[model samples]
Target: MNQPHQPSRRILLKSAAATTAALAVGTAAAPALAAPGDTATAAAAPGGFPDYRYVKTLLKPSQLTYNPTGEIIFPCIRGTAGRLSAPLGRYYLYYAPHDAPGGICLAYGDHIEGPFTEYPRNPLVANVWQPHYSVSHVSSPHVMWNESAKEMWLYFHGENTTTRLARSKDGITFTYDKVVLSTSMLPAGTTETSYARVFPYELPSKNAHFVMLFMLNNTTNHRDIHWGWSADGRNWTFDQKALVSHNDVSAVNIGGPHLLTRGGSAFVVYNKDKTSGGDLMITEVGADFTLRRHLGRFYESAAGAPDNGRSASPSFGTEGGVPYMVYESGERLQGSISVARG
Candidate 1:
């Protein structure tokens, strides 16, 4: 974690940096915006959104093993893991399903990387209402341990125009307790009352009081990721600038933001839809929250997905003290999860 004032005494990186499918692979192949090592994947903007580039391949997709019977399922974007700030320990892997609207999950490991397990009491949904009794309203979850509160939290997107949340004690279980923030609470026309966040992430700077990043649809009618900080995690105020917005070639929907602290800054890894099969992109942001420069495209699909699809969340952290990424791969229709290491 970067302190508010003191700069890290490490590499001055010019600061720019799920799931399985037994499902179907989308139809179109996304343009190779930039090859694996091309730093130009990220374009520079004047003063609004900072320029960003892809880092290296984090977790590329892999199979989700059902510990009990060892059965693998489809669409394993699962859950978001790791703590947003320091003392980052608790890692929650959520299974994408509607069986339990707020059915929370727990996958605890000593280090960021672990052969994590699916705890039996795993699904921790308190009183959450599912879309269908068969479908869980909880999707694209970003779970983390809040140091200040001395507990773990589940921040996720759901049916309502708002994001829902629940708190837990043992990390694995949550009391589907509350609806922390919903779009209905925002002033009218806050970019369509329907825009909702997919995944929730923690910002590195502690100075922001309480900080979090989320995604929403804009007037331009595209999806863009944004941030919010609360003196209290429950009462957050969003940042003025759209943390991330529409791109020139892409229709602009940025979902699943994962933040990693490396070199000296926090590098964000996410996905972009270029009107074709989506490509995963990355970039680095300064301590002041300014976009730095482009990194490059980590990996491009050898094929295209049918729904013009791509998964947003990418995994990043020190696994076995060695950095590795655990992300979902392939297109939904006939895709499965795969893993990669640097």
Candidate 2:
């Protein structure tokens, strides 16, 4: 494993201060901030989840990945959390670096606020689907630890068209499993099914253990959010319903569905392309994973800056009851990953 070069405390403080100032004035209403001596808990945002304050950047683009030569890679997207290994006392982050020979990668850190060290044997999930799909691209990973199965279950897409599965006892080494869901599982007219979030949770009234929210593309190139359920993490049955359609929201494009559970309620955070740029929106999902209550836009791009291009591809995780988000923002093709707390 190659450890990240740590920066000095003074450098970190100066960078954080600049980022905080930009966030404070970027939006019309500044998010609630934690007090001077309060490094443990973030203040809650009104009409949002409690004790959720927007913290500064966690992993900037320059920190995403590195080549064999130790050169920094850019344009990393959809970094998702698996589980906090109680035994190891570390958190696992699986992300997709949208570069050549693309595949899923892994990073681990002692804390969510991290100088996360990248696993040297990265591309943990390699681009082995080339012969089958004719394209080696593999990205958009969503991973979660399944307690009942005693393994970390990873859900990701290949060539941005189908969803697949992999499992690992330890978060590092993974064995490829079958394709759990794909366009074949969607309705007759659907074109593709990709970019999914899979996790284990009991419904308010049912004992079903697995839930998935994925993207369903149509003939017109419009992408809608759909969901599915599974008795186990491997087998899935599509609900054949659109959770968020293009017409349902202001944005023309809607993708990147991430589920955050807090206080016994489940919230879905997704990305949308607004007229100005892009926005990250949230909605409350019913315990059954059917009913949705839109929570409006949570983060938007800053005007005339690198971020003004767009803000999309969000992943959520919490540490010690404090919530954090890692999402892609900046000029679309040249975008980078940024972290915020709430």
Q: Over all chains combined, what TM-score does candidate 1 have?
A: 0.60
* TM-score on alpha carbons, each prediction: 0.60, 0.75
For residue 244, give model 2's deviation from the true position in Å: 1.2
lDDT per residue as tens, model 2, 137-254: 6777777666677677777777666878888877667777878887878878788787788766676344467788888887878888888888887887778879877677766778
- RMSD, candidate 2, Å: 9.2
- After superposition, the stretches of candidate 1 with alpha carbons farther than 4 Å from their true spots are 1-92, 98-103, 106-117, 126-136, 185-209, 218-221, 248-251, 274-277, 292-294, 302-311, 333-337
> For candidate 1, lDDT tens digit of each residue in 1-342?
111112212111122221111011110011112222334322322211122222222122233322322211111222223322332233444434322343333443343334555554544553244542233344545555555665666675555355666676655555565555655554444552222222233444643554565556645666666666655667666665566655622535655555544334545555665454466555566545676554545444334331124433454433222223445544442333333333
Q: Give the Cα error of residue 108 in candidate 2, in Å.
A: 2.2
Largest TM-score belongs to which candidate?
A: 2
Name the lDDT value of residue 286 in candidate 2. Answer: 61
